[model samples]
Target: MKAERRTQWLRGVLDLCILGVLYDGEYYGYAISQRLEQAGLGHIKGGTLYPLLARLEEMSLVTSRWTVRQQGPGRKYYVLTEQGRRVFEEQASDWTMFAEHVATLIYRRGE
Candidate 1:
């Protein structure tokens, strides 16, 4: 179905989307998910978001720290590293070019 294909496409670029969100500043897991949803990414679950965060951390693209809140347990906040910024910049450029090409192909006029 179209929805399923859309989900697959979204997954393919989820990392870039996450990096874009983090580019602004640090965010906790829940906050990241919410921001992505607000940005039209739809409802991304904790299961999916957490593992990606872990992978980004493992790749040294992001760093995290636990901040204790007054009313509840601590939350782990993630921030983009210098390397992440570079990666994001490169990836964003690549994505823009790729998207333009795809759009052109999709909208091409018949000769």
Candidate 2:
């Protein structure tokens, strides 16, 4: 599996993934990207990530707050809204089923 192939697939589910991350708690932009990579999503750049965050905000799926820090510049942290939680739950269930079906086809398992 090449990186480009994965990137194409990722676009379809990035929003759900971001919501899934926020489900645990709040995270700033950079940390969110780190968590995504840690979860094997790969490195998502700001150019790609920030706009998605903005779109999520616009969609009312997530809300953000800026926390001031004495040590350095403040960061905007994002958290999932109540509606976002519901949406995530629904999408996650759908994705799980869809992924299983896709895997079955790809692997020719249970045929």
Candidate 2's residue-wise lDDT over 57-84, tens digit each?
9999999999999999999999999999
How does residue 27 of candidate 2 score in lDDT?
98
Q: For candidate 2, list the clashing residue pairs, or say none.
A: none
| lDDT (tens digit, per residue) of candidate 1 on 1-111 | 477886899889999999999999999999999999998878898889999999999999999999989998999999999999999999999999999999999889794
- Candidate 2's error at 12, in angstroms? 0.5
lDDT of 1: 0.94
Decoy 1 TM-score against native: 0.95
Question: Lowest-scoring 10 consecutive residues by lDDT in candidate 1?
Answer: 1-10
Give candidate 1 regions above 4 Å deviation. Answer: 109-111
